[model samples]
Target: MKPNEKQVNIELTCTEIGGLWGIFIQESMNIRFLTYFMHHLQDEEIKPLTKVALEISEGRLDKIKQIFIKENFPVPRGFAEDDVNLSAPPLFHDIFSLSYIYMMNRLAMINFSYTASNNVRLDVLDFFTECIHTSTEMFGKVVKMMLSKGIYDRPPKMEYPKEIEFVQKGSFLTGIVGKKRPLNAIELSEIFFNIERNYFSVLVMLGFAQVIKDKKLKNHVIRGKTLSEQQIKFFNNLMMEEDLLGTVPVGMEVTDSTSSPFSDKLIFSMINVLNSVDISLISHAMSVSMRTDLTAQYSKIIAEVMLYSKDTFDIVVEKKWLEQPPLVTNRKKLLNSD
Candidate 1:
């Protein structure tokens, strides 16, 4: 942009459009949840953390709105105040909201990094870069809060390596049968984090199921909870096979409030989004894992999650809850118009 040269504006690429659209919808939903939690949160220390998170989401929504308006792109009808009930009794304890913010920010960092890396537009790139910075800050604050509360589930500690060592045996990757080499640090880290993620997933399904009144949606959430539980057990078994301590749940309690704080559509959409994120993370785990058995386990878990995600998508579509993304026009249909 210069005084002599006219500013030439380029239309957004498909990826740019998709990234902005997706973030808009997610941030809008986050704003609703954060607003509800702020209404009920009583812990003075955690209240500030929740407030920062809400501010971040609100800012993102406003920025995305500006971009959409500039491009004349239709804004998505994402979740709003009507989707959340501020007066509903607390469905989750204060600790759960803190943990939820921690997990959401972690996932946001991963997603924003990916989206930023793939796009070329200066505005879009800058937006995601700023997002990464804010989310990283929020994540650190939440972790500190969790640690101070003595509730953070730290990854397992290991003794220092005696020396720099290289693999000596062809059996380094073998683990499907007989005695195998002890789990490498990389494999162990992936297993630990994946199990931790599934714990959060289980908590979401468990809490959402209790408040959902629709029989079909309740059953689906329950099924998702069972799937998360099974994955956790499988990952824990892998750790035990190596004589390592397994991951323990964070014990974030869910209240028995049968009243739903969110609309059925919102609850269903939340679960749906959680499942989709789980699949992406599991796929990443598969890529980083080294041991044959660990890779195989990751593969199996991904397959299960993919199948479950499809079922969730089908239900969303059936219930008319799925939002359509921007798409290319059909040239053939245009040419054949009567």
Candidate 2:
């Protein structure tokens, strides 16, 4: 090899850049919430858990910053200390904080796994692989904490079938007609988790609605709460049809504090993220659901959530709170510019 040879490092692809940027923004927002929660946390049992979560988010942000710096890319201005008021009174209980950590870690695991699968760049792949591992570890810790505190909501258990069974009739696929069949294990599992997810959203929206100052934004959040309730009711009734009940996780409670702990922009961004994730979750649920009723109901829920998410996007744009993600070069526009 020639001593004068220089190594040509490959540049980041659009997907890799976008993934890191999105994760940076998300981690920044999460850091703010965790900081505030840490300030008000009273449960000694989960204090270390919350601290670990904060450390993980902060570490992720640092890694992203390093990557952007090395690549000579402009660092995104995500949420900051200014976006959260650490001195504000607690708007939710400690149990709710634990639940939030558990759910957020669950989401991080799902998203990071997908990002890892799509990116072939060595650095980006390694980063997401670490993210997946850390998120899974955090999720397990939160689950254990919830269980120890007697708040973990277990999914409904089915009785063991003594004999193997097969679908003998076409009624298994029919849900809207007379005398529909019972909910199968997979169908029941999907409905069960969706109910749990919406219930958490309902709690968060209720708290946000209470503290949001703008009448319009408050109303929008209230509408989100109502939508979550409606979705929960539908899932519950669907379960009742099979003579089974969906377990609603308890111990999450919002305080009476009307003061906002987060900036309006942060609040709306959080809502936007949650609603967008729900749309994806419900769509996936629809694909797995075999019963016509379940699929049809999931479709309707997706449509409603999509509309709600659109409003959130508009609000973020109108308020100039939306962060522009990385995009492909606009060759035509660049050529047209003076």
lDDT of 2 at 305: 93
Best by lDDT: 2
State the lDDT of candidate 1 residue by residue for 155-228, as single tens digits.
88888999999888878878887667888778788889888888988888888999898898889899999999
Q: How close to the true structure is residue 213 of candidate 1, measured as C-alpha lDDT?
A: 87
Q: Residue-wise lDDT of candidate 2 within 1-338, one digit each (tens)?
A: 36554332678888888899999999999999999999999888878899999999999999999989989999999998899887788899989888889889988998998888888777778889999999999999999988998888888889988999887888778988867777778888888888888888998998899899899999999999999999999988877767776566575589999998999999999998899889988998899888898888999999999999999899899999999997788999999999
- Per-residue lDDT, model 1, residue 183, is 80
Give the lowest summed-lDDT range of ten residues in model 2: 1-10
All candidates: TM-score? 0.96, 0.95
TM-score of 2: 0.95
Clashes of 2: 0
